[model samples]
Target: MAFVAMGVYGTLSAPVRPLTHGWTLFFFVFNTAPIIPMLGVFAALYATAATRAEREMEKEYQRAENLLLNILPEPIAARLKDDPHLIADEHPSVSVLFADIVNFTETSGRLTPPEIVQTLNAAFSRFDTLVEKHGCEKIKTIGDAYMVVAGLPEPREDHAQAMVSLALDMIDAAQEINESGQFPFSMRIGISSGPVVAGVIGERKFAYDLWGDTVNVASRMESHGRPGIVQITEATRGHLGDEVQIDPLGDVEIKGKGRMRTYTVSRGFAP
Candidate 1:
């Protein structure tokens, strides 16, 4: 429109009034015709780029949220997002389970590093599934040792029972892995139920872990446990009803706790 107006103005303002030349009108029409379409093209490009960026950013946020959930409980992870300070809480009762792959050193000697990791991953991944199935929280794995807990972050009346079931399932999973004939391994599992102080520690490398005498005793139970057996503290045993079978392992001199009784549990309730 501006170009047309300019051409009309130039024609009318001439020393002698004359009709606008064909070339002048054609020039104005040709230039003005593309203006709206060019603007639309640029607008479309900007919109597409913005939308793509937004989707990418959203995807990144989802990935981060999943990673956080993997590391900590949902409630705890939400709290950290709000304020990542010291996160410590005392639970009156929570059952802790620790399972270490037996004779890992020898297994490593026989296989390459990648092979060792694959073998460990296969076992731990199965344990992870069982942990979720039993409604337990996996604490962390220390080399071949896999740790988990129940009745924490969210408490339940059946925390001990859940841990027991998880341990039994884990033992079964390990047996299956070994039965595969490729990666032969046995698991020694320990469980204890009592008061514990749980919290998130470290800055860049954050870890949600448990402390207190209960944690120590659970570790002792695992270290002293027999291979291919689910060794559990009396505290845990006390919580188990008639739902499971147990054999007395008698008393052992725990490092810090002096003498303590332990037991081995079956996969299911006694007939």
Candidate 2:
């Protein structure tokens, strides 16, 4: 319409005036028409790139969140996110369970490094599932040893029972793995229920761990325990009901702590 109007005006005024207005309008459109589409193309490209970048950033954030959750408990992770300060808590009653593969060092000697890792990974991964099933928190695995706790981060009345159930399930899982003939191994597990000071340590590689006498006792229970059996402290035994069957292992000498009565769960109670 502008071009038509300009053409008419130019024709009508050609005898009296110059056609400067028409030429100016034509030159203006000619100079800017290509640039208009170029600007739209540039804007679309920028928007697409921004959306892609945003999605990539979101995916990376989710991956980091999953990694954090895998390392720390859900509650602890949330707290750490809210406050960067040190995270520590005292739990008067909680059950700690530690399990070590029997004769793992000897077994590893026969197998290659990759085989050792594969076997441990397969076994611990199964135990991880059982921990979740029993509503327990798996602390960290040190080589062939697996450590877990119950009634922490969120307290529950039956912490000992949960640990017992988890131990039984883990034993069964190990047996199944052995039966498969893929990785044959036995596990010695120990449980201790008492007060423990739990906290997050380390800045670069964060670790959530437990301390106090209870932790030490739990470790001793596993170290001194018989292969393919679950040994527990008297404190932990007190928490169990009659429905679960337990056998007296008599009094055992635990390092750091004098003689303490320990028992083993022989049978009964299936996970």
Candidate 3:
């Protein structure tokens, strides 16, 4: 733009007619005449560039939103885009699950770090597949523990059954992993059914997460569970009914959760 302005100034200031009385200058008003047009052209070019950039940004934002919807539910993703609020959703009738590698610390000690990670990923990958198949949503992973939900973002009439089925599938998947290879990692899963607030956090690159009494109770169930078992709270047991056999685990003290009656789910869901 500066170069063009200089060129215009040079041409416009040149005199239209030779100077009178032997004045040396030939170029005059014409040299300065083109400067305004040069500036106008530069301004037009800048505006065009800015518009194109804005269009690109909008496209990128849309793509990100589409991916977010794929990972999360539609309503949640929309809330993330349309509103500036923390995207927490509370579902009073959903089932939550938590799973961890059985004796992860001891099992990890036997394998190299890479091997340990590979084993965990393989197991969690299978758990993810099962969760998806059973119409469940993956909450997140805290190291060796995997958390999942059913009928949270979107409602499902048989969320408890679906959750139990997912837990059974995870057990079967773990058995397959144990038999297929030398890795000796088994799995334990815990579940709870109640209300929780689920949402995404932060302005840039947010994560879909959940909270509430139910979430905390579910975590406690996992932390105080037996290996290769699916321990559940009374709340979830009530939802499950007699669909799956339950072995009463009696009332157990849970840190920050008080004394809660717990039970175990044995056998797979019958057809």
Candidate 4:
């Protein structure tokens, strides 16, 4: 249409020229016609590139979000992303479980460094799965010891019961790993229920951890517990109803706390 308009205009204003009108129309069409399509092509290319870049950015953001959630709890991670402040909370009633791989130190001495790490990873990975299954938070792993908690950042009425179920599953998982001949070891688990201050610490590594006497006692329970048994503090045992079976370990000497009676999970989940 532009070429036709230019042709008619050039002919009407030809000024009696011979080939000038035709040349003028040809010049306009030759130069201007290609440019419009070229501009459209460039615009299309830019739009496609921009859309692709946006999708890539979104994917990258999602990957970062998943990594953050893996490091911290979901609610805590969301809060950190929004406010980057110090994340801390105190829960009056929660169950903390600490499980240590039996004879890991001695076993590591006989194996190479890679072998030791692989063994620990395999065992802890299984424990991580169980943590997800029981709706608990795995705080961190200190050497061969794994720490997990139930009832907060979201509180539940039966935190101790959940921990007991998790502990029982962990024992069976460790046994399965041992039976596979990948790493032969047992787990000594301890549970304590009480108040705890949980938060995300360390600017560089950013570890989500717990602090309080309850955390301390839970660690002690794991350290002093016998392998292949799930030990629980009297407080934790009290939280469990008749649905779970527990046997008293009697009054035992705890390092920080005086003689406190503890119990062990006698059987797996009843129902």
Residue-level lDDT of model 2, residues 1-271, one tens digit each, is 9999999997777466445888979998999999989999999999999999999999999999999999999999999999988999999999999999998888789898888888888888999999999999999999889999999999999999999988988888889888998866789999999999999999989899999989999999999889899999999999998657888898889977889999988557524
Candidates' RMSD to native: 3.9, 5.9, 7.0, 5.3
Per-prediction TM-score to the true structure, in the order listed = 0.88, 0.89, 0.72, 0.89
Off by over 4 Å in 2: 1-19, 266-271
Model 1, span 187-210: residue lDDT tens = 999999999999999999898999
Q: Pick out the ten consecutive residues of candidate 3 with the lowest summed lDDT.
A: 21-30
lDDT order of candidates, best first?
A: 2, 1, 4, 3
Query: Which regions of candidate 4 fall more than 4 Å away from where they truly are?
Result: 1-19, 268-271
**Model 4 per-residue lDDT tens digits across residues 142-188:** 88889999999999998998999999999988888888887778989
- The local lDDT score (0 to 100) that residue 145 gets in candidate 2 is 93
Candidate 2 residue 242 Cα shift, in angstroms, is 3.6
Better of 2 and 4 by lDDT: 2
Q: What is the lDDT of residue 219 in candidate 3?
A: 83
